[model samples]
Target: MALRANRVRLGIFFVLIMGIFITGIFWVAGGFSSPVTTSYACYFGWSVGGLNVGSTVEYNGVPVGSVSAIEIAPDGRLVKVVLNLEDDKFRVDDTIVASLFFTGITGLQDINLESLPDSVERLWSEDQLTFESDMPVVPVRSGTVQSVASGLNAVFQSMAQVDMKELNDQTIRALTRMNDLLDSVENDSVAVRLSRTIDNFDAVLVTYNDLGNELTAAIRDAREDAEPIVEDLKEFTGELDNLSEQLNMMGADLHNTFNVTNSILQEIRELLPNVNRLLDGFSGGYRGEEIWQ
Candidate 1:
């Protein structure tokens, strides 16, 4: 009987140990004890762990719950997810946002979770709320490179389609015209005329230089001769001034003498006429025989 009792006690202990081990396994797999639930509503296109479970719930890099259902009402697309959060920081009305991020050099993709700006104070609860994700903005490097390549291709195509024969003909025509113009200038008599003109210019310059020297010498001689003539004229003008003073007094005496001569001439003219009349009367009396009367 004691041996059976011992066996039964061992069995009970073994079962308890097995139960504890099973409970620990479940706890480890489930990732914690009964955490507080922070319910929220997520949009339809959000995903978790490569699986878009309609609207999924996550907290601190661990999946907590999945979307129970989805519906579209007048307020827009609504998604409801059941959350099992371990902390009180995640509560109702908190904004949930998802972001796509790249990992590894091969550009593997993963979704990152973050609360929307100012979503901390407004925590989520068991209520219909909105969740948003930034729109994916594609980089435009490849488009820019393709545009540059297209421009280069158009330029090369234009150059390749050029007419080489027409260009060569134009070049040849230009060279021939240049040769003809050169030949015309070479055959003209302009070179001989230019030489003659240069010789005449040289002779003219020589004549001009000789005439300039002659004019310089003539000016010097004229200035030397004019000096004495100027002094002589000055002395002559002084003498004429004195002679004019004496002539002025002599003219007054000549005026008085001329008046006396004019009076004597007038008396002589009157006596001549009276003497002729007296002679004519005496001659007539003698001729008529009574001369005394």
Candidate 2:
């Protein structure tokens, strides 16, 4: 029985040794916990948020280092956080920023390390530290959201205080005035006056039509009566033409009688002078014969 108990104890011891040997082989082969000595410093006026000593440092989302120390200058102006990296990662001669970032809304913050393009050799010595709040200039999304919400609240409050009664009263007054205007236009007296004016115009048109017809009939009668008299005047004109020819012949004969009388008068003028001379000689001879007797 004692031999059997010793065999079981030896078996347990062998299993324990094999387990530790396998774990050591796996750890060495996987190259876990490979530490590299690289130093980085925070600038003056910069901060690492809430990170403390021994906090894990990440580079490009991969674990590369850890925070070794955090300190403030004797002047109380500059803060510094030194990190030791195991991934051969080193900072250039430029400024680096350390910020606090939350992966979600859970308020759990992590250390975010970033480098700036300023001269680090001019500010910090080798293995020294510095810090700043304006290192990366984190934008405040929550603050902007709060400002927008406040503006919307003020607009809604102003709208709630408006008075609607005056607007409704003005609308009602306008509607009442429009109804009264329509009622006045629909009155029976106005309709009757329009109808009478139209009837008077129709009567005037009928009177003008009757006058036109009378004037046309009078013109037709006058034309018919003057046509017969015009024919009689034409016949009278032919008789007047024959009478003018007879009068012309009689005027010619009267002109010839006047010419014959003028010739007889001229002969009598010549014979009168000869007869006077003969009568004078006979008178003187008769007087002497009477004396001799």
All candidates' lDDT scores?
0.44, 0.50
Q: lDDT, candidate 2, residue 284? A: 30
Per-residue lDDT for 97-187 in model 2, tens only?
4444554565444455555444322233333323333232211111122234445554454445543465456546555654555455435
TM-score, cand. 1: 0.26
TM-score of each: 0.26, 0.34
Model 2: runs farther than 4 Å from truth? 5-9, 29-34, 44-49, 87-98, 106-108, 115-293
lDDT digits (tens) for residues 1-293 of candidate 1: 99999999999999999999998999889757555654333332222233333334444455544434333422354222322333444432234554334334554433335555552322112232343322221110111222344455545555555554665565565556545544554343444545654565565566556555655665567766766555555655655565565456445445644554565455556445544543443332111111111
Best by TM-score: 2
